[model samples]
Target: MSDTTTTVDRAKRGRSGSVILTDRRCGKRVANRTKIYDRRCPGLYVSIIPAGVATLSFKFTDPGTGKQRSTTLGIFNPETFTVEHARSRVYALKALDPAALVNQLR
Candidate 1:
């Protein structure tokens, strides 16, 4: 997704890298105008939405087309979810058989 934040700053600070995100780091990045990808999680990202509500999302290569795509996993709810929980979801998604995932959806 695009944002009003300049590319220069993002590039200098890095739009993506190796730093692990803590709860506070997640909060800070969530406020940024661009989606903040977690270096530790290949397909996981925090979408740049309104402050106080960070949306956890995942990106994957579409098997059929071999193209990258993204989808929302859920929003961060401290009482119900946290960074570790979200990362676990990403791992779960990665571990699931694609066909099984589709069947579950049905």
Candidate 2:
């Protein structure tokens, strides 16, 4: 296979394939999964519960406490908001001044 084809294949399979995830052969739901990271963006992830609910989440450090934290961004839906939305939100968060983010958190 070509290099592009191999790369696409790898992404479809994911590294773990812990859950079948969407069908690699064809776009279809195979099973409810958990914890899938976006390779294109650090700190962005999606988790699928057994009931098939998916949520978008982002990991960051709390400036006030100097502790790491994760926040749920929104419901993750391919038709609605997905990885791209999470990545954009993370980017926006990174652009903020530390104090502003803490204030918003309050």
Candidate 3:
């Protein structure tokens, strides 16, 4: 088919979608989801999925291996777990040693 499929816009917060009459060149992968970045917290973002559920993730560099890694902090809850809390969690994880961080991964 000439038309690829549906397109979704994940820019900014809240929900956004539209019927984009896009004519893209063939043979390229299309992204269906997007991440909501936290301005105050680096590496912390809300991962949006096609199932309409968003989760919190913390990306960091492994101190022991020096390799980049990511871990799920928790579910993204505006009331209980805010961006500030996510930032604090990032700080806490940074303060911990690699071994401890592995054990403390949630």
Candidate 4:
């Protein structure tokens, strides 16, 4: 038998560190934007689109299928979102049951 496993970033694997404003801004300006997960909060990340639009997102694993799942929290822009707000959102989302979340997807 063969085994296959997909691992996310080390920081995302567990509580690693907190995300700062500079990190988020840099991600938005990068040519090839990728997900920048908050080390202090598991499953919380910022996704910067090609046009420099940054969005707050949450990632979690579904217990039933053992697969990763994600959802958008809000937009991370100067007039709208902030790191504190994002952290609070993450706290709220973390309290939800994974199974319930999966069912909602269906």
Candidate 5:
């Protein structure tokens, strides 16, 4: 019998599969089971409230220093004006990186 090896290209694959986003408050990765929603809105929206209204932020992990830091991306109105709606809006914002999406809208 001849030995044969198969090669797999990881980058070509759709996603990292096991990759995760951690929640700063809970100190746990945000699970895929979380809910998301889409809503119609008018005018410009911003996510300036860091603690409230589900502001967009980025978490940076430093390997050498073993430290993690978070930076605010921007402020968005979300337009729902409700807690439940805000949560869903935040989830979509996080996943889609609204900065790019918002720019494309204009």
Candidate 6:
């Protein structure tokens, strides 16, 4: 298995910017966009799609066996799903399994 990391800027003219990862080998993409109101708190805000919603999803991979898995972080809730919440979830997952959050790229 191979590990690749990518960052994309989805900052539209009047939209928030997003950073994502593109997994070349497995062809998966994960969105890692965070909103920063002040410079002091990095990644204080995060956005995630709500659960049980029809939206794009992020894939996580196992580093030991090199198996790919996908899970729904949340549904797209612009108001409820803040950047900090998303980041916290990601961090929590990472703590549980560091290799479980390998966002696949398309």
TM-score of 5: 0.24
Report the C-alpha lDDT of model 3 over 9-82, residue by residue, as the tens digit. Answer: 55643523322111121112325554555655666666667555566688777667889888887765556765
Worst 10 residues of 4 by lDDT: 12-21
lDDT tens string, model 4, 1-106?
9999987777444322445534445344645556666777777778776787778877888789898888787887665677668878778766768676766545
Candidate 6 Cα misplacement greater than 4 A, ranges? 1-57, 97-106
Models, CA RMSD each: 7.9, 7.9, 11.9, 8.7, 13.4, 14.0
For model 3, what is the error of residue 7's alpha carbon versus the real structure, in angstroms, after optimal superposition?
Answer: 22
| lDDT scores of the candidates, listed in order | 0.70, 0.64, 0.60, 0.69, 0.36, 0.40
What total of clashing residue pairs does each candidate reach?
A: 0, 0, 0, 2, 6, 18
> Per-residue lDDT for 43-84 in model 1, tens only?
888765556567887888756557777777877766776778
Which candidate number would show the highest lDDT if scored against the true structure?
Answer: 1
Per the 3 Å backbone cut-off, how many clashing residue pairs does candidate 2 have?
0
Task: By lDDT, rank the candidates, best first.
Answer: 1, 4, 2, 3, 6, 5
Candidate 5 structure quality by residue, lDDT tens digits, 1-106: 9999999997555333322222332222333322111222211122222234434333434334566544444433335243334345445545554455444223
- Put down candidate 6 lDDT per residue, 62-104, tens digits, no spaces: 6766887555555444466533454556556666645434433
Please give the lDDT score for candidate 2: 0.64
Where is the poorest 10-residue window by lDDT in model 1?
Answer: 97-106
How well does candidate 4 match the true structure in TM-score terms? 0.64
Residue 80 displacement in candidate 1 (angstroms): 1.5
